[model samples]
Target: MLKRLFKLGLIINPYSGIGGALALKGSDGADIRQQALIRGAEKLSGKRMAIALQALLPLKNELSIYTASGEMGEDILSSMGFNHVVVYQHQAQQTESADTKAAALELIAQAVDLILFAGGDGTARNICEVVENHCPVVGVPAGCKIHSGVYAITPKAAGQVVAQVIKGELVSLMSGEVKDIDETEFRAGRVIAKHYGEMLVPEELRYIQAVKMGGKESDELVLSDIAAHVIELMDDEPDTLFVMGSGSTVDSIMQELGLSNTLLGVDLVRGQQLLANDLTAASLLEHCANKPVKIVLTLIGGQGHILGRGNQQLSPELVKMVSKQNILVVATKSKLQSLQGRPLVSDSGDTTLDEMLVGPIPVITGFHDLVLYSVGSM
Candidate 1:
């Protein structure tokens, strides 16, 4: 009798994170990808896929892999010495969302037990379009805005979840959301995140990221109090450069200071004066350099992410520039209570920084009020 091998499907969006570091803000269009490449951005989806696949090395002989041809899948699997069958061939040199959907359909046809893909929310949307609830999938976080619940908190965690499934361990299945935002509105400092649909995913609370909570803060009184406290601080430190992060909580502060805020983008202010609006990563680094900078941030409602969800503008370099002590977090008491005691997450894509950020930090809940909370990364 022969052992029945665990069959796994793989798909890599080779251009997923190409526009992130370059400040293009998304990898959705071919023209955007070309712009990023011309500006010297390298495709990092393959490298991210490689990191996730590392954990499956020991179980190689006990598994069978299926994937798309070339950079979409085969290249990385081949480099990693995993024997895989190319189930679909991409028609164009540059892979599109259509390629991802086609590859997923082929994988379902092959009856793979689980599909593991690397990309952001856009990639998740493509997979959901074809697979729906037909097959389970795991996503590696490798895009500009990872505002979806389908992705693992980190690349290594993604592999670990897949490994559990491959080892025949008890991994629960649940519906993961496929959410995306209009890049046009996003670039214009507006966040209109909408739920496209859902897909069956292997559930691991420690590994899987939570879906980003949408809508605005409804407690007008609490928002006003929180905003007042932040304004008081700004008055006390007249010389400090304030970097306003995204979220309604921070936006409330901007409103109190009598300044227009970028609803879904980073802004800059000094002594209650608006200096800049909707800055990119490079712009942030240049402006924040050699200044006494303090970053005003707020956690994502249900996700508890203070960094690396939609605020990719706060790149690792910019975070380091401001230092951890200079970060001021504000959220309503009810908002913090909604997490039910899950620590805040800082999935900044830099393992070292994420580790460095682990500890208790102060959160301003109201006027002259603060509470200590823990921050962690998967």
Candidate 2:
């Protein structure tokens, strides 16, 4: 059905997204991978690659893929019956970020038409370091916290983009930011994201996502209304443990309650008292044991995500302990509208929990103002 015979480059960060379900926050370097596995984390990026490659199968005869051996890319592409050449070989026992960089360098040396990689922001950074603006690239969203604009909205969307690229349908190239968060601070329930660099991504407005937004805004009237509503609810249940998530909107409620809250971390509040400040996953679990708990979260502006972005401290296990009904979501009208009517996303790393969070969820926008918004997997 397509006539173009392009040299496509494929690379996979086999250890990408491994730290997600384990609640390790960010998956970078070999030590993280080993720790993730010890904590029972499974391989996800390879399966994500399989999903994207399936979509490009129809172009098998017309595409020549250059990739690394084994889990990087060759295994999946070869099994899919696509013509591929192994450009790099990994050490097998130790595949680090250097392996990814080597693969990208070899792919660039081959002068591939397009490079497709499966990982989170870290993998994007590795590829961007070597192939910046030299060739078009697309990222498959398969990480714990994806703050990069290089990733597609979903893996299926990434597949669609890859197919279109092979068909020569997408012609625009736009710069996408590659960001990385401080893993040490992240595991401690503090979010510190920094922009590493940028990469050229195939521009298809439908598939690309926006970079994470930061900073604060003060809306005294509206924030006061939202804070009053939340305070009233907290007052009704004196014994319930309230887990507060980060963001300016949520911070407003904490300020009104006269309790200290983390501006970029998760905190625990119970009956007008600050029980914990910037609690880690293990610490939250330990404190919440045998206690009735509720989670209060705020949406990320522009990106409709209430979980799995910067609040990795509220791990999947901790969320399951609280359940969805006990979760409180509060956001401003402008923040909700910024999503353009899309449901909020949760990449909490636990697939079953993500599914359980699906369907229409209630969000408190203002004083007694409620909206039932759908929740989908990212």
Candidate 3:
């Protein structure tokens, strides 16, 4: 005989995107937060959450927010003058995955209509373990690498989607995969991704991103041809240093050269030998010091991102070392087709670098085949 107020849950992994601009590759655990900060990585999650929450301010009175204390959620909501209830407490600078899980549990107990989180795939994994379809959830893109389908295309998009839901719009729900990667291996230039599980997510097709699909076995032949083209280019300039960005297409080139490469991390090669196995932004800069270098990358399927998605190791500074003219883009015809006429995108977290990447760039789609495609901010 009682009606509950329309309630929504909020969680913020304050350190989510800290590792990105620092060129840490991925932001998964808490230990890297300090290292990121030391490297001048900004606390992007809070700022991003604020961006998302601002969209809901007009309807603040119609919905109530249940969230964790401090940086987790309360601080942002309070500052925005939104109506929110803190149901969980956490340490200021010591919040861990455990804290995220505990906060999710508390939010679920409060019978919130939906749970919106801010973080990367790892943060999604922690929440997936506790939520498990208990309520609808969404993600605000504020991480280094987001391979999960639950996230909005951008923080502003996330706010719009949540605002629509809070207004009682009839939005469908779907199960979104929670993708996780090994940070140690990732930093080592080896990407090992595993499916943790799935969670209920609000389906706003225009705003939400799809889960990152794995490299298909059928793409091997196409990759091999692409590799051959890159190898020939390398042979002509034996003295030039080639910085390899992660992806199966680029990995195929290393395989063709018979050199070991980090499939999910940056690698460096000089002539026919491997110069560096896996490299961070600092390591990349160190190795390429005073050396003429070129960057080789492949477009991310569906997303059409050539940088700033899963390849933070290729930082703007490193890109400067390589120079845009020396950068090589590789993709198969099918992969390019997946773009659906949209231009390739870049979000390297550096506004100037992203601007430099604007306009048409050549993409190697096959052996001796080049296609000029436009690059824009995502």
Candidate 4:
């Protein structure tokens, strides 16, 4: 249980991940002319609420929650039976980033201990764009391409960890992944993941940890070999959306493909053409709208996160369109060994997307070989 009298702020972007799932061509989509709910948005939002409810339920007697108005904040609390938990005083509608910024600023003004939010990497970037490390921040994943390290493994897990932090449980705070992607290219089957910055953990959250790095260092020769195999696969394929994620490993693939790629950036490749490079969220989605796409990414060695690290451009909204089957993980055997006993930490800032990526998945590093990658919770 959490210690008493912790004032927390809550905010949500009720429509954050809805656009891409609608095939509407962007992550900014909040309305559909078709008059039905977008499944992607609902699922992500539902997961956030569930994890939050479960995590906060045990601490109701001792804590107070201050939240934004309407779908973004109150509904989650209402569903969890939090009538007395003072909702934030709203000055306007709950639809834009301004709303989030306003509410966040208000929360800070009120001296809230921390703010728990649910959104994507863009959302995290928005918060970080305006606010600093004045107060602790946590994320409940409910967006598409999350690359921000503000989120926990699950919404409930986020809540549980926050509770632990409040109780001063000797946890360690690690620098989180601050990444965001271009959603426009994401649609046209292109991806441009960029590192925005890092976030701070409250030091009591055990379920959430920093992305780990290898201690032994890299063997340039092996990376070269793995990169060659991935490029060969790319060359043999028919005209397809080749979404190349970031990192040195992927850069090797681009070199073999004869395409000039951003060394530490996401790039879009389709057959002989280089579609887009170094794009933002809006850019990736615009490209992926109606294309046949294949995602090629290398796993983060020790953290095990294939998409969340240097590739935040693969948002939940984007992932929904790509589906789990479309994702291809490329890593060498040596790399897999490094990740063998760790959880693929996804501080993508969106809890729901991380969950979607959790579990044993195939790691394709060399030709005709795939290893299963498993996620562990500490």
Model 1, 1-378: lDDT tens digits are 244567799999999989999888899999999899889999999999999999999999987999999999999999999999999999899999999999999998886767899998899999999998666789999999998888999999999988876664434456688999999899999999999998767754221221114433447877787788888888999998999999988998898888999989999999999999999999999998998999999999998999998788999998888877688899876687788777789999997777667654557776755555557546
Across 236-309, the per-residue lDDT of candidate 3 in tens digits comes to: 99998999999988988998999988999999898878978888988998888898888999989998899887
Better candidate by lDDT, 2 or 4: 2
TM-score of each: 0.55, 0.53, 0.53, 0.49
> Model 2: which ten-residue window has the lowest total lDDT?
205-214
Candidate 3 lDDT score relative to the true structure: 0.79
For candidate 3, the TM-score is 0.53
lDDT of 4 by residue, 201-264 (tens): 5434222111225433245655565666566666788577878888877777777667889867
Scanning candidate 1 in windows of ten residues, the lowest lDDT window is: 204-213
Which of the numbered candidates is closest to the native, going by highest lDDT? 1
Alpha-carbon error at 238 in model 4, in Å? 56
What is the clash count of model 2?
A: 0
Model 1, which residues run further than 4 Å from truth?
Answer: 205-378
In candidate 2, what are the lDDT values of residues 1-378, reduced to their tens digit? 232256789999888889888777878767888888888888989899888888888888877889999999988887778888998999876578899999999998876767899998888878889998666688998888899999888888888887765654422345689998888888888999999888767644221111113423235766777788788887999999989998988999999988888999999998878988998989999999989998999888888888898899999999998977688888765676577756678888898888667644556665655544556544
Clashing pairs in 2: none
Cα lDDT, all candidates = 0.84, 0.79, 0.79, 0.64
Judging by TM-score against the true structure, name the best candidate.
Answer: 1
